[model samples]
Target: MTTASWLAIAMATIVSAALAQEGQTQSEEIEELEEIVVSASRIELKASEVGSAVTVITAEEIERRGDRYVSDILRDVPGLAVNRTGSFGAFTQIRIRGAEANQTLVVIDGVEVNNPAAGSEFDFGSLLVDNIERIEVLRGSQSALWGSDAIGGVINIITKKGQKGFRGFASASAGSFATHDLNAGFSGGGERYRFAFDASRFSTNGISHADEDDGNPENDGHTISQGNVSFGVTPIENLDIDFTGRYTRSFLETDGSIFNVSSLTDLDNDATVYQRYGRANVAYDLFGGAWSHRASVAVSDVDSKNRSNNATSFTSEGDKLKLDYETTYRFETESIPDAEHAATLLLEHEKDTIQTSSMANEVDIKTNSIAGEYNLSLFDDLHLSLSGRFDDSDNFEDEMTYRVTAAYNLRETGTRFHSSYGTGVKNPSLTELFGFTGTFVGNPDLEPEKSKSWDFGVEQGFFEDRLVVDLTYFNSRVTNLITGSGNTAVNLSGTSPAQGIEVSADAEVLDNLNLIASYTYTNAETADGTEQVRRPRHIASLNVNYRFLEDRANVNLGIDYNGDQKDTRFSPTFARSIVGLDSYTLVNVNATYDIHENVQLFARGENLLNEDYEEVFGYGTPGVSGFAGVRVDF
Candidate 1:
């Protein structure tokens, strides 16, 4: 027994003879394994008993999927890859798998909203899927309990707690070029305390390619406004307190074509930016059954002013401060149900200030960590784990990362087996130090990108688990992947080879239908072999939802596929591929209606295959869209 334990004993003897001939029953294509998560092993279990690879989006699936930011509800995640270059507060990137969208990691209730002033990155348009209630996506490398950007995984944005009685909601939307949107929120509680508030506004108009809407066509569009407030208190229930605040004011303007002579006659720069964000949390339950504790603090203020009607000008104003504290412990003395033990102690501090006409980059960072994890489910379904992390940073210094995961549970024939091994590191973003302006130039000796990853998977649940099937094979090498060099000024950290393969399927097969399919195949290369710029190497997605009338009306459908990338540049003055971005497929539709007992009505349609794609080549995304809304609960 060695060959992965004889392929896990021949896949647990063909899943225990297919679960003794499908014991659970009913099968159209099984699918119903939805509650179990311990934040990747802070200990909770049940995203199929977690080996790793999890995705959960709830809140009634964000109200039947009519998105309002959060990168348009992640376009139905699966090895995600979202790139919305402009429209809705401009500049967006949510790369995963092939990594590099600031190395994925965004937490909300647990604090850490990235962006330590100059691209620590966390901009899913500053999140707001209407006071979200649940969203947990932990694909891999949770840095052994979340530390140092969780390296290509971890997206926990949980909000909305306080529903034992009072509630409220509102929504509005419009379509076509002059898109418009409005959102509203309310939450409540008693017995101790509870509160929530939300607000939003969005608008877009810029894309008139046929006749070229030029009067000022630097791409013509954008305006966004947002507000949020959340507060909760138990004061004593073993102590619990929370606070969240958000404000975003965007009036972004863009059209910098100093001279490409085609993007609407080389329009000159037009830019303005402003943002403010805040967070706070406290929870303590030590001495209780499963010891626990938490403390968090965060802040971000960015005001950017850039103008160039002719005389070139760019102003910079910044601020970011974060402090986080963590403590968690799970128990079982006289234990051994397959034993369980977990611990996490972390401390983090960061600061950044950048004032630049051309350089005023500053940084101060601090990190302290302690990680210990142990699990043994050996015979009940087999599970083994190990974890490690130690980091210290002031711009970069002490570092260490380690991980291992194992899981097996052929539960006599329903299948489940997983594997993982990891390591990752990345630091270096104050705009890579001086905020590389205009023609791209800034590299204060940049360097900070490291990696090593591995994953092997197999999951099948033909019926009992409800038609779930997943297959994964991943690999990574990465090593100083940042690149820059307009012309010999130095700093072009290369070397990469991030391989990938992830396939997914989730079927509920009739009971009001629900099917989700996924696929991702990447091969980001670059160490002298090029082909990794603007990243993209095939990503596919399909989602279907059904529930009509009796379920109070519901319907959702989706499809997205993107492939075709390469826009390298060493500087032929600013290369532009042979003009990449060719593969395109988009179609989206959503519907909801409950009509009473609180009020509900919804409609959404996007792209509907109005086919026109360009995640970033000549920039223009957002076509054939429509929206209608009505929501209220109290």
Candidate 2:
């Protein structure tokens, strides 16, 4: 109590223990910078070095979850599931865990756009959102590096190349029943030379039901027209070139959704569709050596019609093609000395073509591929991933897939774990190998539906970095899984496997409030025991947000829950056209206000607690809907 006040309390206890050990080494360096990840092992490894389970949706959370297709921005991302039927963008479906929709594998800006005559799957309502800037979801089973629907995972959509300047904007919206008009374009000399153009004309007199004004059931009324163009060039400065074009046209009406989707006892129906997509790219980067290169190409087309109400009418068409190439090599030494090493190698080639035209029937098909991958890390938080692929088809022959991943982190309790195994192949669709109704029969010695999946996960985080958590568990097996007997639509009967569990979370919890959550569980049956129908054995999501002005104003809210399913073709020959779906919850709200400095004002509402579900099965959605817009920046 007196040697000069105990030397000033021992210099304040050694400066509070060196500021709590430099704040825990900057909170373990921001949790190793949020476990920096790269779409699950396509090289650029990290997500704890990839075992599996990778989810990222940037572009400012897809503009605050406003949704504009990328499968409605992955319906709140968490084991994913999106099923919408009719709303201008009718019949949109994206299934992850229960694995359908061709087992899911979509990539844009990195090519491989799926839908090769409906084999790999990609119609995410004709993908559009002006110009996607980020998306990376690598759930479980990536077919060893993306070879055929990855068996319920792998989606990459990255777009936005106009480095800095030469702005563009235009948007419009009308409510009560949907109406949209938009325009956009970009002009050269910014990143050397760049160009982009977009167009839209949406329509809807939709959603009001309460059955009968044909369009066939649930809400009714619709129309759509869309267009897109993208171009880029940097001729010098490391050379780069890009191109994109797209189109869509639609019109529909189906009796208030077939009398709320299969009840109005005697309602009527009608439909339409047309889609097209094209893309190209070339890139080269060689900063003082170690090699770098990339190349790409893609094309897709679809045509459709189905005018019925008993008057009868039908038509269909399809086409697709894809190719890609890559090369990367980077090396830095001292691997065993002072730890630091980076290495990577990747190679690929792909192709596809499919055709179908039917007033009843017509078919054509093709798919070919070859691939390879390699990765390594030695300080970027320990990582290793490898991949291999080979596929050949003209009716199947030659198949193989390989994968490996390892990640480790404890760098003082940032806590992480990873595991993965993949192999998938799903081929057969031209309406299941050349289709035709009123006497179902189509099968050209069908054989294709091999699958194997795996996943293991763990994640944790805390404050100096706004809480985050991730938990995962997954299992899969397909083994020639396709079913049909008595009329054969591409015969296949036996294997059907599925099992799952998932939980995801995110929290900034107030700097401006942020919270996101997810939960999913599934067990798909079918050993002829049926129960793979509308796939829902539980699903949930919640999101909340608030951020004012300086952050450029914001307000957001969302909630979705689903459960209740059964109707695997309800027997007795489509049992009066199977129907049974119930259990739903939906609510959404949004607002953004900048209103100045470049202008911004937004408003949104979807279902806003209007409930009354149905993702298909008697159709019903769109109860309180809304839209308001304004966005300008130059």
Candidate 3:
């Protein structure tokens, strides 16, 4: 049967189930749909009120999974694909809805951290899951609200904040491959002031970047040290000030290319990377919180150096500064009783600079943008939002983008219908326009890539809200796609089309057991009807969490499956050809026990089945490995 047929059947089944349970009241003990989401709009709103697809990963879930890297935690999200070049600390990338890696925007505490020197892409290799309170993954075209580099989606990483009282935590862990991880943090707050601090270090003697089975014997090691600080103060009534700062330094052992053809050989190569990010904000409220104003500034800096045979061969530095001001007004009218409305206006300016060893002069790009948003909620049943943005850039043509979203709830039937439509634009990156030595040639005439996307979904609840299911269909078309042609970056004349389906379910099977599962089917193709590289046709995951031993001990089991995909291969015999990668499945298990009220012990096993798999061609993956850790809270 065709994909359409499958979708039709699934929709019919869900609708029928919803109708069967119409007019039923939810049990009081069942969970409610009151989760607050901030990334979907300028202001906070309930998840059910947002029309776009969003997934929230909480700190509790991160702890239960025992994943050291944030990328590992995102593998289970629908419509997302994570590829790690090798083992831990290797280069990692994520694709959303078959979009290019550089199209996804990453925000860390209101700071854009994309590397301007590397084609505006954010490498997830060095992003650890330390001191993170929650992560909101907003999928789809979001340029209308977030400006550039948001053609695919947006990821907002929010760190933990200070609480009413003083608290602190420390953890130590050791695992396979001679790995060690240590972290500590403290947070405190009062009526007028709050502060938090965190520090961590991780080191591992990882396997070879090239596949060991291919005669690579050398071991590549990686190390990282990171620190974070946050402070907030309320000097007077209705006025607030906040600040955040983070720094990360990392070292990785890489592999060199063989005869300038393949990077599948074990050669002595290394890289050092440093990242610094800071943000400050001031906000005030007027007219009893009906009107609010905010101003903020953020900065990000990245420096990287690569060495070959103990000699520095390449170095690059990039920095970005952003300034933003926003005002929002909320009101309700007697004509529309119980209806809520909000209007927001935003102004932003951004500047990016890149300096590399290969270039004699530093390069800079600047952009100024204005955006507006309006939200309406009718009796808490019908929600609607409209947003628009205009951007003027020094390097690219002026662009305008817009987005519309709607969400409707049938509370009597426990059903919701959500839909969104948006347009996006991505400017040419510095590297693509100016080129990098020995890699890509300059293409100053390259045009900006543009896209239009839309999605519709239905969410249904059953068994007094004990089980919930969501299904969505998304489609997108891109024009002037930036690609490499014989080492020269150029824009394609034809349009590339992509479509996909995402299905996810969360169920409370028992009082102590919970299950989550998701499946995605994607059909991404180039203009010539060829499948896009690195995008799998099918992906699925399942996870189960159970609590036992008087709620003091917990266990989690996770399984992930990646379907066959195509990748490009370069060999001495052939210039380049498409190669097929076999499908693989991995199983992971984690368990935690509370030794005391303020202490816990945990252990996790990765790749328990020992299935040999490679996310990227010519890269090696870790075998079965186990880790044990202890955490103390005071």
Candidate 4:
């Protein structure tokens, strides 16, 4: 039988099976608040109880999608825009709520991974799906808890942990453009000690980063290898210690620069990048579990080298170290017998250093922070949270930020109402304050950017909690906006404002079918009414998934639509010009079927429609492509 026929039959069988238990399942609807989350509050709390806009991508979803890069998975998220220069291993940038790429904080296993030498922007291209367990995208100003580079939001990646019994998996795939992916991992644990290790290698004879029409015909290729290792120990009950380490190396052929702007013209340049991250954490419980304390130390390092056939070479390196301590206490009061109060205190210190080949000396920056949070739960239906942070740094002025949030659950109506207001501050990046000459001159007297943001949202659940609708409105105003004008970096006197609305829905419309849809509208511009470059005003996505054969087979189809936007193009003759980039749509599909208890076959088709699009002007994008693979578990 054909693959389509087989899928139909399998789906029918699973649907029948699901129908048999539908009555019972519908009667026992679980509360949405029971979904555990950590990033929204820096502590464990139910999703419905948190007042922030957050999206969680669990490992199960990651595996089902079979994404090659983290950006591929993040594209479907609401209130975020992901852009890439071209095919595999290209530079990827994600803007949250229309914030600049450098304003978002990226945390991998509790370590900040932003490159200090690159304006504190973390390249999404460097991150691969190897040993990740979950990803939390928390939207809005998080500087109240995470310090600088958090004016936009935070992307927290949590890696996998060892299981109780020994388990391992291996997977391999090959596709168009001479692409290949190989991955393997194993995890095991005893009563006291546990360990997990994973490794992956991906390579593609990629398309040129620059458009062929832009006089770039030579093909650009990329190769990357990554590994992760984690260990944990439980010395005694209520006490745990953990350590995680990760490394990635990438080499790619890139086009030359136009007007000193990389990835614009074909120059036959080669670039290599290396990233390393390590973190250690310890947690303890005291006073009969009423009080909890945790401590952590983390370090991240990044190095990059670029060379051209013209006998020119450049190197840049960044290193950072972080220390953190936190304590939480829970108590009850007689005045509110049904209420509980939890208070947390946090202290953090960080040191960052950056060096470049042309720089005479390395730049070092230090920052320290103290923060506190108070949460109150009344009658298990209303929640209130307040947090504040104070930061002291040597590079910019000192600042204090705070956040206040409230959430209420209407059990009878199955609705949740939430609202939040917060303040954010971003210090000048090392490259903006003390960068090398020739490329762009740094402004030592630049002031820090400050922001005030607020958001209100409502979530409604229906059909025995099988369907959920969410809507949120957010707004932010940032002063001391920083931009580069003709090789000179300066802060604009006017403010930058971003306002947006997000709407999303999740539905299990059928016994074995699921649907997810989202839409976002963003108006991001300068105070003087200038539209931001490459910030799309409208974006939407729809995803459908079906499972069959008693959950042994499944298929997922996704469509994403990106709206038109403005971009800047550079050329020696034209100097610089503003251009309008047309909007485009992309469709992707993936499927998997179990052949044996421990083995499965999978296939994927990307850009099925082959629509030509450009996230950045003069950059090439991938066309329709297909891949098939097998995975084995033991």
Among the numbered candidates, top TM-score falls to 3
lDDT of 4 by residue, 466-548 (tens): 76778999999999988886776788897899999988777676767877777888999988988888789988787778899
Segments of candidate 4 deviating more than 4 angstroms: 1-33, 258-263, 310-312, 573-575
lDDT of 1 at 356: 52
Query: Candidate 2: which stretches are off by over 4 Å?
Result: 1-49, 56-70, 75-87, 90-120, 126-136, 139-141, 149-175, 178-220, 223-304, 307-314, 317-392, 395-401, 413-465, 468-506, 510-512, 515-634
Tens-place lDDT per residue, model 1, 46-125, is 66557777778878777776767777677567677787654555677787777777788777665566665446777675
Computed on alpha carbons, the lDDT of every model, listed in order, comes to 0.68, 0.66, 0.90, 0.86
The numbered model that scores best in lDDT is 3
Clashes of 1: 7
Candidate 2 residue lDDT tens string, 360-381:
3345556566666666666667
What is every candidate's alpha-carbon RMSD to the true fold? 24.7, 25.1, 3.3, 4.8
Steric clash pairs (candidate 4)? 256-267
Two-way lDDT contest, 1 vs 4, winner: 4
Better of 1 and 2 by lDDT: 1
lDDT of 3 by residue, 287-375 (tens): 99899999999999999999999999999998999999999999998999889999999999999899899888889899999999999
What TM-score, computed on C-alpha atoms, does each candidate reach?
A: 0.32, 0.31, 0.95, 0.94
Candidate 3 whole-model C-alpha lDDT, 0 to 1: 0.90
* lDDT winner between candidates 3 and 4: 3
